[model samples]
Target chain A: MDFSSKLLENAVYEMSQLPGIGKRTALRLVLHLLKQPEDQTSRLALALENLRKEIKFCENCHNISDVALCEICSNPRRDKSMVCVVEDIRDVMAIENTSQYKGLYHVLGGKISPMEGVGPQDLTIASLVKKVKLGEIKELIFALSSTMEGDTTNFYIYKQLEGVPVKTSTIARGIAVGDELEYADEVTLGRSILNRIPFENSLKAN
Target chain B: MDFSSKLLENAVYEMSQLPGIGKRTALRLVLHLLKQPEDQTSRLALALENLRKEIKFCENCHNISDVALCEICSNPRRDKSMVCVVEDIRDVMAIENTSQYKGLYHVLGGKISPMEGVGPQDLTIASLVKKVKLGEIKELIFALSSTMEGDTTNFYIYKQLEGVPVKTSTIARGIAVGDELEYADEVTLGRSILNRIPFENSLKAN
Candidate 1:
């Protein structure tokens, strides 16, 4: 689209570089910012710049943090012996929101994806393996997504922990709560049946 | 949702303020930026801040510009005697994209909406009238949207130009190209019928 001002064009171009935003949406967003108060625009700019400049990662888990160790890694109440491994910070947030798990997390930053040129070395997999080799973690939960990349990363890490003495497991797969079983995918449905929980254990949750 | 870093939370909050963006999408965008190179984040922030701080408005038309008078308004090839009045810069860009209009523009910034507490006084109506009184423009095209607010803004501006020597007209409304008559809304269909053009004139185009 033709823009009357170069500044407007530049701003829209930069905004459209974001993951999901397109040119038209970027223009709309930039125009909205133009209509807003200067203070709002300045605040947005400042927040983004400061976030990029000052943001930190947990030295232990590689999740985004404001200090050397993230809150979860620093918390004494969280179970250090039971580490739930995830692909990124979003997974960490999602698992934390469930409020059912009191274990600590080891964020891998991303899963192994050969198509994207991301592999074990590109992520925090080595650090996680070293942490496991320290012999403190008693159990390692593979909480990555059920995609091929997730499975590949989980298997890679599992292979690295072959003789590390930590019991390993994956998160349960089943029909989501409030979802009809008929609508569930075949693989998930099949897995759910094969790994069916005991009746008394299911009744104990709710 | 909780964020491990205060800076990340602030950036997400500011990003979610844009139209159509929500907390989840905001988090995704912020995290995506965090994963990108530092220069990418800095460029986006700098572009937005600079656009807001250094943008200019055309003195003649109130459209966004990088100069005192916008390119279209300052162009010698444009018809200074014919002005297309619009609600905002987006309309100007849309019309420009059609490559059909050769007239100057007068951007009102917004249509008058009483429900939203927007009045004629809040827009660029006064400066537009002043321009009309200068006797340079011989025709005024009301190219605002076909809404109640658009009509109110047009009529209000029309009243302001009472006894002025310029001819006034609104853009024609009709069923869009490739749209079936049966599916067309009643108001637009009825207006299209009543304002039907000569068959020869329609055949002359395309």
Candidate 2:
């Protein structure tokens, strides 16, 4: 006999397609769900359903929202002149969890990757350029990851706003305490070199 | 600001109820769901909703199924005369996963725990005795855990079938190699002693 149920197979297949979930893990998760009260899994299903049916991308920044614009974009309290550009909605949520930033967000959908055929046109870069053309933006902080593709995308965005008065900045990289010096990759090492900070009493003599 | 949306709070509250999931993990999971494409989360919700609406316990074995009797009970090839009683559906699933057991099953829902107010009368033991009275079943296997409640529950089931003409038996116990003997509790140790097997070749010769 076949080793799995049709519904279980279907459910596992769908779950495996999700980010970070593979076939074996998906099967285990499905079995775990089966062990729980049917309501648990049922509620998960309802959340998924509501997410698709009720949520929409914000018209201005393309961030996920249940209304015309996302909460951040719609709110008057958020800094309209300062936009934090990120690769996806995940980055936005990560920043929100920190509770530090009050700026609006622009989700690029994905970073430019030549090998993956994800060019600048594939992202929301053109829309971002159009937004920047309005000249209301005082700053555009690039909170992208410090990978090769991320650098390439950042450089691409930088080139687009060359003549604009907006001040662009990438997140600073610093040496991590307790990190093995031997295990430190060359790029991080190089970035640490470029962004080195001053000692506490070094400027006293000067 | 409180720094948490009402939707985010609701999602976290629901996720916190899951076993092994804590507040921070629940928050992470909720944020991950919120970051996905709206359709993805919606499909997840639909699957959960269908889980409850589509599933029902099998009337015979109490195994979760889409119908009255599970596939095992309704199958003609399985041995109907041999019944294996278990503590829960998870035990039934464990045995079924082995694919070697061809007999029917009786799920007790839980063990007989006086501390927890679970008694034999609350279990499906009466129905099991009724099945035994039909005079067709010849063997009854107890696939219970080796815990105190398991032993007590097994003895209760044994007493309930005083003269039913069925050969009753529990699984064998022995010294599991490389396992910590010091950590082996008294119940397992006593059961192992009760079912000891002669290890020395000289003893067999004698």
Candidate 3:
């Protein structure tokens, strides 16, 4: 049917703008919302308004917060001595769900993609450096993607802390242990060789 | 880390409520919003709010509309006499996307179910029967499921329209050709047999 209603057309246009949601999906969602009671649907509107008017970025970590500092940065129990640097706050959240690491985090705001017009200057790297210079941190983990830009970021960050007396580490690279050798990609094989353990020494010790 | 603000907690909670979206995913969506330029994120919120606020239900068909009548109901080219009945407005939108159907639609709001405390009174069936009784409509299509509740609804609707002149029809039911025998269930087999083609009748007529 011809879409002549301005409200529906606007609603469809707005829903289409969301990531992974298209015009058709947007229409579906809008229709779904319309099926709900006035109270529930209106409350959703209130939530969206509140999200815009009330939510604020943390001044310290650039993570979402209502206050000046984010929860991760302000938590006293979190390990402040070891910091994990990520491309964005989403990465921080992903790592947090794994429950494997206890270190505090620094959200870079984004990777240094010159093609995308994002540079180190555009990120929170300056704040990161200042935090590192505080003399409390002993290690920095580069939890970035394995893209060329990620490598460039790693080298740039390594140079930034050249004489800072801190150990820098990247997450390991290898084929998944049970994965077939034939299925391994070149990058995985290369990283496996570069990070190969001392197999002979371990065998002799055993 | 402990959530320090209700904004963060609320975003996380709301995000988690969406299907397949967890607390971490909500955090990701919120954090992504945090990194965006203020205006872009503001638009997302505005869009959401507009979606909730501006959208209204078409009184005639219950489809979403910006005004009193939805686009479909207002369209002069659409056949007002043929109403495609569906369970939800989302289904209406889905059918609308095909750009093939020209008939008007009747959203049942929900199917009848005794166990769920949903009866004939809970749905828009009464309004539908009234619409049919107006004597303008020529066909009443039962696009409900082929399951037990769908059958019950069809029977109830058929009973309600007794002595009416409009012809009634339903979406077809039968086994899909080329489906593996091993995978075909008893219900499908029975349907296939019941709806068996009359190859012998065609041959004899020739």
Candidate 4:
């Protein structure tokens, strides 16, 4: 769309470059900033700039962090020998929120998606393999999603750790908790039945 | 939600301040930016800062502009005697895209909405009335939205222009173009019938 000011146009263009934001939405957002105090925009800009320039990643897990080692990786209480592998930091956050597991996480950055030109080399697979080879981790849990890309990345890593004297396992896949059985997808329902655990074990989980 | 890095949290917080953006969406957008090249975030931050710091408003119509006088106002071909009063620059751009009107625009910044603590004094209505009182404009067209706040703002401006030598009018309310009459709302359909123009006049509009 035509804009009256070059400054406004430039701002809208840059905003629309973000994922999921279109031109009209970007214009609306920029106009909103104009209506707010000038300090708001300054703070937003400063925060983004500082995050990009100074943000760090955990040396052990490759998770986003403010220091060399993220809080989860550095915490002594967390089970360092039991590392859960995930696609990104968001998954790490999700598991952390549940408070169900006390293990450390190893962020893969992303899964192996050949369609997007992402391979095993594009992620932190090498570092994880090195950690396992060094005999630091006793067990590795594949907590990636159940998608094709996720399965591919998990298998790739599993192959890398062949005969490394480390136990390997995957997260369970079944109908979500609190979901109606009638509405569950066929594959998930079938898997839930096939992988059904003992009633006492399920009771103990809760 | 918890963030691994303080910088990431601050950026997400500022991003979520934009209208319609929630915490989860803000996190997704921030993470997307992190995955992209560093220059992308820097460009977005710089553009927003420059726009907020260097933006200008037209001295004549109060529309966002890069100069003292907007292009539309400074154009010799535009009819200065006929002004279409609108809520903001977005409306100005929309009307300009129609190419059906060649008159100048008077942007009021926003409508009078007491619910939002917005008053007529907060807008550019006084300058428009002063312009009408100075005999610079012969016709004043109220093109604001049909909401309660829009009508209140229109009536307030009309009252301020009382006893002035200007003719006041408002944009017509009717069913949108290409909309089926069977699906038209009762109020719009009734108003369209009551305010029907001659067939020849309708033909002339096209």
User: Which predicted model would earn the best DockQ?
Assistant: 1
C-alpha positional error of residue B126 in candidate 4 after TM-score superposition, expressed in Å:
0.5
Q: Is the docking of candidate 3 incorrect, acceptable, medium or high quality?
A: acceptable
lDDT per residue as tens, model 2, A1-206? 12223455566666666555666556556667766677777666655455445556788988766667777898999999999999876688888887778989899988999898899988999999899989999999999988899989999999999898898987677557679878898878887888776765436523
Candidate 4 docks at the CAPRI level of medium
Q: What is the C-alpha RMSD of each candidate to the true structure, in Å?
A: 5.1, 7.0, 6.9, 5.1
Off-target runs (Cα >4 Å) in candidate 4 are B175-206
DockQ of 1: 0.90
* Preferred candidate (DockQ higher): 1 or 2: 1
Q: Write the per-residue lDDT of candidate 2 for residues B1-206, one digit (tens) a residue.
A: 12224455456666566555666666656566665677666666655556546756678776666678878789999999888887765566555655557899888767898998888897888888888888989877776665678768877878888877887766444434334332345555446434433222212422
Chain A only, candidate 1, TM-score: 0.84
For residue A57, give model 2's deviation from the true position in Å: 3.1
For model 3, what fraction of the real interface contacts is kept? 0.31
**Clash total of candidate 3:** 0
> On a 0 to 100 scale, what is the lDDT of residue A44 in model 3?
47
Question: How well does candidate 2 reproduce the true complex, by DockQ?
Answer: 0.23
Interface RMSD of each: 0.7, 4.1, 3.6, 0.6
Those runs of model 1 whose alpha carbons end farther than 4 Å from true positions after fitting are A175-206
lDDT digits (tens) for residues B1-206 of candidate 1: 88898988899999999999999889889989988999999999999999999999999999999999899988999999999999888899899998889999999989999998899898999999999999999999999998999998999999999999999999989999889899999999999999999999888875
| Candidate 3 clash pair list | none
Highest lDDT against the true fold, candidate? 4
TM-score of each model's chain B: 0.97, 0.77, 0.73, 0.85
Off by over 4 Å in 3: A1-4, A56-60, A75-79, A97-100, A176-183, A198-206, B1-5, B40-54, B69-79, B90-102, B113-117, B145-151, B171-206
